[model samples]
Target: MGDRWHVEVDRSVCIGSAQCTHLAPAAFRLDAAMQSHAREPEGEADEKVLEAAEGCPVEAITITLVGSGEAVFPPEE
Candidate 1:
């Protein structure tokens, strides 16, 4: 829990891999439509959230720090 993070799953890009859920169950879950949804944005550790984002093969997960709106996982470079 390094900082408050906002985790967003791009439904258009999510391919039902459920990798995010496996990496950080508390932060993500698949809906009935098989789209990944952010369950508890604050439930998982910051590192886990980052891992979930990095593990997404489709790169659907986008994590931003609260207040600052800084993209932490993707590394906007």
Candidate 2:
């Protein structure tokens, strides 16, 4: 199995601006009801995921390394 990343969003904090969708379309999607949700990135593009999280106005997105269970936000910067 591919190494996975766990993505969580505090929907209450999300303003539905869809910035994450635009920044990392491969890692995020909006459902038919327009609810934002996470999808796995197509390889080691954790940076893209991090960008989406940072781009979120409300900071609703949180990314965790699946195997290590470590937070990937604030992205090593």
Q: By TM-score, how accurate is candidate 1?
A: 0.87
- Per-candidate TM-scores read 0.87, 0.73
Model 1 has an lDDT value of 0.83
Candidate no. 2 TM-score: 0.73
Which tens-of-lDDT digit does each residue in 1-77 have in candidate 1? 35687888889999999998999887788999988998865433477778889999999988888878887878889
The per-residue C-alpha lDDT of model 1 at residue 28 equals 82
Most TM-score-accurate candidate: 1
RMSD values for the candidates in order, in angstroms, are 1.9, 3.5
Instruction: Give me the candidate number with maximum lDDT.
Output: 1
lDDT of each: 0.83, 0.77
lDDT of 1 at 39: 88
Candidate 2 C-alpha lDDT tens digits along 1-77: 55567788777777788999999898888877666788753236377787899999888888777768777774655
